[model samples]
Target: MTTSSDQQHREAALTDTVLRSFESCTDPRLKLVLQSLVQHLHDFIRDVRLTEDEWRTAIDFLTEAGHITDDKRQEFILLSDVLGASMQTIAVNNEAFKDATESTVWGPFFVDGSPEIPLGGDMTLGAAGEPCWVEGSITDTDGNPVPDALVEVWEADENGRYDVQYRDGRTAARAHLRTGDDGGYRFWAVTPTPYPIPHDGPVGALLAAVGRSPMRAAHLHFLVRAAGYRELVTHIFVEGDELLADDAVFGVKASLVKQFERARGATPDGRELDGRSWSRVRFDIVLAPHGS
Candidate 1:
């Protein structure tokens, strides 16, 4: 008869056998990574006393997540965001940029090839949201302007839905612009609104299972790139947003939040805005050196 000691011995043997299988790996880093992964996975299974049915359910959940992922949607990334893995990865890799703009999770909705817009052009494209003007300068950590930097921006409409969500093959509320010689750029966009991540997939179901809400705070995404600096992927969260303290993806940083103030009659650069009241935000971004 198999006793408790027998089961323990069998488990130990299985872990050793699996680890030994990686002995023939030629790459030292690969071998180390695989061995460490195996050890931690085995320990977690033991600590949780994971049942066979639970293992099966997890496998099924992951399979479903993969199945739902496509060109326009990334369910696995969504899962990573909900589980805080994305933020953790960002934290580990972005330690040197403390003086520069802090990095945050690049949500699953970023699309390439947004139309290039000129300075002071409108990015809202008639999408429904309060009109807002965003002007920012790109500078090095030493406060020197980094001229001719490319700034890519994208955000959801007032209803918190991206252009991709409609599957309509059109881009809205997204654009790219180059900084002028002064490292300054400006464009008009809609004020951001709180929205839930795609919640119709396995990640959504997992959030429901854990009694968690999937709402992200109001924020605008920016990707700044220059010839000789580290590329930055980050967000400017609206100050005093109710959900800022509880972003579903934990992407909010106190330094990244800015006050989007209400304005009347004129823009920041002294141009007459069309009689309608608007919101204005000024964000100066600093980039860390490439090797920093």
Candidate 2:
């Protein structure tokens, strides 16, 4: 009979051999990444003593995830989000700077070429939700204003559904606008409401298997860009939202949480609400310099 120690040695040798096979990779960074990935992945398999059946199941899960992903729904990103991998990657890349805004997961719902709105304009575009006034200023770590910054914002409707989810080719609740000379921006949007992530796919199944919920915290998305600063991708969570403590994607940061104050009177730009109650939030953001 083969000794247990010999089996362990053989496994270790196999991992070394795989690592050596990447020596021919011309790219230094790629070689390093591949080697590290192989090292960790092999160690995980050895530590868990993963069986063939379990490996097959994992492969099946990945296959299903790929099968369900499309332009509108990204199941792989959903899987990464549920597993906290997406947030981990974001954390690793978005290093902290002096009072700079923290970055978060870029959820799968972002659509490029979003329609542009003007300052103090409305982004709802007829999306169904309570009206909200979102105002903010963009500045650098030194407190200098960064004017003409491109700010992109989006959120789900009151029913926890994005416009893309409707599959009717409609664009609502999403827009981009430029900052003013004072680095200020204000737009009308809907009050964010907590909703479950797409739980009908493989990610959802994984969550169910592990006894987890797919609920994401109520929030609005923001992607900010300037000429020389690092791009900032983040969102603001409702202060009192119950899901904040257990956001599905692990995307919430204390600094990103803000109060959505209720308003019953005159609107910010003197727009008549006609007796409709609204909400308002102020989110001033600070950007880190590139390479900071």
lDDT (C-alpha, whole model) for all candidates: 0.91, 0.95
Q: State the lDDT of candidate 1 residue by residue for 1-292, as single tens digits.
A: 2349878888889999999999999999999999999999998987788899999999999999999999999999999998899999988887766589999999999888888999998887767788899998999989999999999999999898999888667789999999999999999998899999999999999889899899999999999999889889999999999999889999999999999998888776676656877898999999998867
Clashes of each: 0, 0
Q: For candidate 2, lDDT tens digit of each residue in 8-112?
A: 999999999999999999999999999999999999998888899999999999999999999899999998888899999998898998899999989999999
TM-score of 1: 0.94
| Clash-forming residue pairs, model 2 | none
| TM-score, one value per model | 0.94, 0.98
User: What C-alpha lDDT does candidate 2 achieve relative to the native structure?
Assistant: 0.95
